[model samples]
Target chain A: MRALSRETTALTLLLAPVTLFLAIFFLIPLGIMAVYSLLEPGLYGGVEWSFYHWNYGRILGWADGFIEEFDIVYLQVLGRSMGLAALTVISTLLICFPVAFWISRLPAKQKNFFIFLITLPFFTSMIVRLYAWVLILRDSGFANQLLEWLGLISEPLDLMFTGTAVIIGMVYIFIPFMFLPIYSSIEKLDMSLVQASQDLGASPFTTFRRIVLPSVMPGVIAGCILVFIPSLGNFVVPDLLGGARVVMIGNLVEQQFLYARNWPFGAALSMVIIAVMMLLMAVYLFRVVKADSNR
Target chain B: MNRSLGKTLLTGYGWLFFLFLYAPVALIVIYSFNANPINVMTWKGFTWDWYVGLFGGATTVSESSLYVDSTDQLLDALLTSLKVAFSATVIATVMGTCAALAMARYRFRFKGFYQALLFVPMVMPDIVLGIALLIFFVGAGISLGSTSIVIGHCTFLTSYVFIVVSARLAGMNPLVEAASADLGANEWVTFRRITLPLILPGVIGGALLSFIISMDDLVITYFISGVDSTTLPVYILSMIRRGIKPEINAIATLMLLFSIAIAAAGIYFKSRNTAQ
Candidate 1:
């Protein structure tokens, strides 16, 4: 018992700096944001503590101010954001799944180098990656040039600053993220189980569906969370590639704080984003835990 | 009945995926050799002029003056980025390793909460964290600049290093340490000699990961950075705003090669260590 106490005391001493650091820098700032979200901004860019209003509530459609020009515009924005995030996830998965499966099947000698190639681009500036997409998707850019060269189109297509461009950019940036987790899962799967399924008269697709998919489902779920969360909150890709025409939830929050100077409203938007993310994380964790226990 | 066919299909799918991943990067590298900087897509002809120009004289060679032109600004931003990433990685690594050791060795009540709290920066939207930190700094009367950005990065990156180190510690049996102690070493000495060595590789890996993340980070750096404190990504963002540059492509291609080289080295060393 004394030894345990000594060990714990030593541990506490070790953790003290980091604990204080997080408490001051992380939790405290988040708390301040939460507090700032509650108060209304005053006449001269100052927050008035007394003006208790739920301007944020109007956005979620949980409350109407009962007198002002409140509407469901925020809800529409939320819907738009969720739709974009969902599309990003679906596209990323579509591109990444086959890639991950293919990479995992490589001879052990060549596998690391293959993974290395996939991950190499990620180390470059993400803004550059998105900008490259801009360079490609622009009307007079590479995509158009290639099409024109192949005699496919007489005129350059108006591809930039659209929803499709944003999705493509998101997929380009995040496919590696999705690929790694699924690849890891696939690599870890028991080969004997797969062989057994084949021997038991299961076709390749059936074996994949019943045996392979189940084993890799955790990775798939993780990949989904990894892709979805960032894609949902991503401000850069849409801002640059989509030309700020598309209103993602991330952009909405940025506008509130920086451009609109609506601190409380931005805070509310952020809180909604946080709440949704937390809820999704909770469901994911629950599913993962359930899956783990069953395994 | 169809194992060979299945294998063939999987192989095809894999190569196709690799092609997709590599094509853009390859395109960027290839296009850097174009004679015309503005026409990146339609290659007129290949030329070594750009590479020569990169070193020879100036970013802007005015017809009047030859000596005044410079790539100094871009070079400065790249250097600043390296400094910030290195600083953030080192600070985060040390603090994070300590925190991980604490969590691993201790039977603390709030350990789970601590673990969850560490994940906030990594999982939270960068823009929000950036703004929250911006507000916090403003409220605290701390001046905004590179230091604030570094502190913000360290806050989250420390968590990353901590998580990585903790996982390593957990996977590492405690019995080795106990045996070391039984052989008559103090806690500090034991950690220095045995524990730290065992976890050093993980610590280095975590540090490298943090360095890459800090270097790649845009959102937080954008909000926190002062007018003069632009990292390479922030610089690239500003440049993109101005318009595309062939030099930017050249810079990107160089950066790409640097990253790939580092990643390859990391993989090589990591595998070599495991093979032993």
Candidate 2:
């Protein structure tokens, strides 16, 4: 009995600080945000204590017309954010998948070196990386300079502030997130299965479709989720690269808070992002649990 | 012949892949030394004027050429970043290490739930967390500043430390701890002598990682950092928004080196622990 009590005491001591800290800081803040999403916006910069559903109604196209007219623009921004995030995921997957395969086939020493090179950017300042894109995509930037020096065109391309620039920036910064998972999955792929499929007279494409795709699907899904979530709520890339042209949902949320001072509306926009994140997580969890049970 | 051709193609593609990953970074590093103050993209004679100017040293460059309004503001932001990262790292490391020990050693009810709860903060969107913290701080009457930033960082940083420490704890041999207990050492003594020493590398690595992350964190800090308490990244962001300058290139290059050095150290410790 005394030993059991001592064990309990030790467990309590170990867990108490994190639990309390997370409760006060993490859970409470999130809970307050959820509450604020439903609260009324004040005239100036703060929120009123009164209940208001129109903050969300503004985004969902059910605003009370008198005070707040529903704006399809918010919904369009949300859709654009998701669309861009999806494009980023697809582009990163396409770019990393073959590279991951190539790396997986390399000698172990070279493989580690390459992996280190890939992950090095992840450790660097995100702003610095984005700034690099700003330099490359600006009108008087390296891309234009290089093209002009090549005698390809006299005119500079309108690259910066385009959706293409935003996607490129997102893909550049998020390569490691997509690469690591796909590389690990490719490393675990069974060469014997591929050989067997090929031996059965399957074409290379057929064998890959039959054997490799299924094996790497988990990693692809995981990489997509990792890339997509950050991309979905990414304000910095769109703000820096997209400028005033390609506004994403994250920018809308930022404007609401910083410029508009509509805290409740900003909170509402954030909740939309949270909703999408939770849904995706739920699907991923369900798939994982199912996979585990099948195994 | 087809297989050999495919192999060559893949090899070439791999090199291109790496080039894509690294070219932008290389461009920034090379251009940092370029003397073109008007257009940073154009190649000019190499000079360290930008780097020299960053440290408040006199440069041949005219005052109109320099974009930064004040070096004092830049230094103040750096100081704020260092302060926030240090305090956040210390608090997060302790809490995370403790939680990791409890979770790894104890088989308790709701263990899965607790683990999931910890992960939510990590996977939650940074914007959501930033706004949530902002609302919470303002509503709770807690002033937003370094204190709030530290608190905000610890919320997620503890989870990172927890993961790193837990991985270390997982790899450890339980028999040594049992042996210490059997040799009449109490739980506390066994933990101090056996577990703590074993996990020291992981703890240090976790601390370094959290420190780097805290220093680099912008989105959350942007929302929560009140007037006059901006960190380095937030300050640099404002600079970039105002205009591109040669000095930013110098600052970025320095930041890149600083982060790479700390990250390399952290990875060294991690790899050493795993190798053991």
The best candidate in terms of lDDT? 2
The clash count for each model shown is 0, 0
lDDT tens digits by residue: candidate 1, A1-295:
9978878778878888888888998889889888887787766555778554476666755565663335677788688778888898888788788777777777876887788777876766687677677768888789999899999999999898888888888888898778888889988999899999999999889999999999999998888888888888888888877776777888888887777887777777888888888999999889897889977
lDDT of 1 at B188: 90
- Which segments of model 1 are wrong by more than 4 Å? A1-5, A62-68, A202-206, B1-3, B47-56, B59-70
Over B1-276, each residue of candidate 1 has an lDDT whose tens digit, in order, gives 577997788788777777766777777788777767566666878765555555655333232222113567677778888989999999999889998888787677887798788887788878778888977998898887778888989988998898878877877889999999999998999999999988887788788878888988898988778678778888878777777666667777777777767666666656654663
Taking candidate 2, what TM-score does its chain B reach relative to the real chain B? 0.97
DockQ of each: 0.63, 0.85
Of candidate 1 chain A, the 10-residue stretch with the lowest lDDT total is: A60-69
Off by over 4 Å in 2: none
Candidate 1 residue-wise lDDT at B195: 96
